[model samples]
Target: MKKYLLQSIRLTAVLLVLLCVVYPLIVAFAGGFSKGNGGGEKITKNGKVVGYALIGQNFSKPEYFWGRPSAVGYNAAGSGGSNKGPSNEEYLAVVSGRIDTLLKYHPYLKKADIPADMVTASGSGLDPNISEQAAIIQIKRVAANRGLTDRAVAELVVKNTEGPLLGMFGPSVINVLKLNLALDELKK
Candidate 1:
């Protein structure tokens, strides 16, 4: 029993150093190699930092593609879901309102046709990407509002889509900010 206790204590000490110290250092070092060098990937326009590539922003204009609904109002400092269950009345009402808004902007979209991500906030609440279907559903509205052909707007969506991880895992997603930035750059 005495030997086992000493072994367990030593193992705990080693794990603490590895996990609490070494792991964080490795992660921080790796982050330095990322696009923003431990910060977020900042997207710039007209020599100004417009937004970060990884944080969601609210885009309510009909001409822009809307991102996922945010529970914390897209506040990166307070990233979280609503924590409301599906059956909760408030949650249902919120989703219904989102559906109504989508239908208002996209009269052709049926509630059944809307993607889940379109009406629901992601777990992070600050998800920068939306499913491909969500972007596709708004193509007609965006084209009509921007006076661009549907084909052109659809091309933007395609161009902005980020494929599955290494092309083998997860579904495709579109970064809404990048897509909108590209849209703004399109010749009207």
Candidate 2:
């Protein structure tokens, strides 16, 4: 029993150094090679920082494309989903409300045309990208609101559409912030 106790103590100490100290250092070092060098990749507008590339921001204006609804209100500090299942009344109502808002904004869309990502908050509640279909659905409203031709806005959407990883994995998605930024650039 004494030998077992010493083994456990040594194991705990080693794990503490490996998991708590070494692991974090390795991750931070790896992150330094990424876009923002251990911080988030920030986008700038007119020399002013706008938003992070990996986190979603709320864009409610009719002229801009919307991102996935965020259950955490797009709070990166507390990033999470609602945790309410489909059977939960609160979740259902929230989804219904989102559906109504989308229908109101894009009148031409039928219920079937709406993508699930547009109505449901993502698991992280901070997904910066939405399915391409979600962005396409908003083309008319965004085009009309911005006084730009639908074709032009559609072209921007096409330009902003990012293909799946390595063109082989996952569905194509559009980064809402990037898409809207491109839209603003269109106006200029």
Clashes within 3 Å, all models in order: 0, 0
- lDDT, candidate 2, 127-150, per-residue tens: 999998998899999999989999
lDDT of 1 by residue, 55-110 (tens): 89888888899999888889878889989997999889989998998898899987
- Candidate whose TM-score is highest: 2
RMSD of 1: 3.0
Over 4 Å off, model 2: 7-11
Which residue segments of model 1 deviate by more than 4 Å? Answer: 1-30
Q: Cα lDDT of all candidates, in order?
A: 0.91, 0.92
What does candidate 2 score on TM?
Answer: 0.88
Q: Which candidate number would show the highest lDDT if scored against the true structure?
A: 2
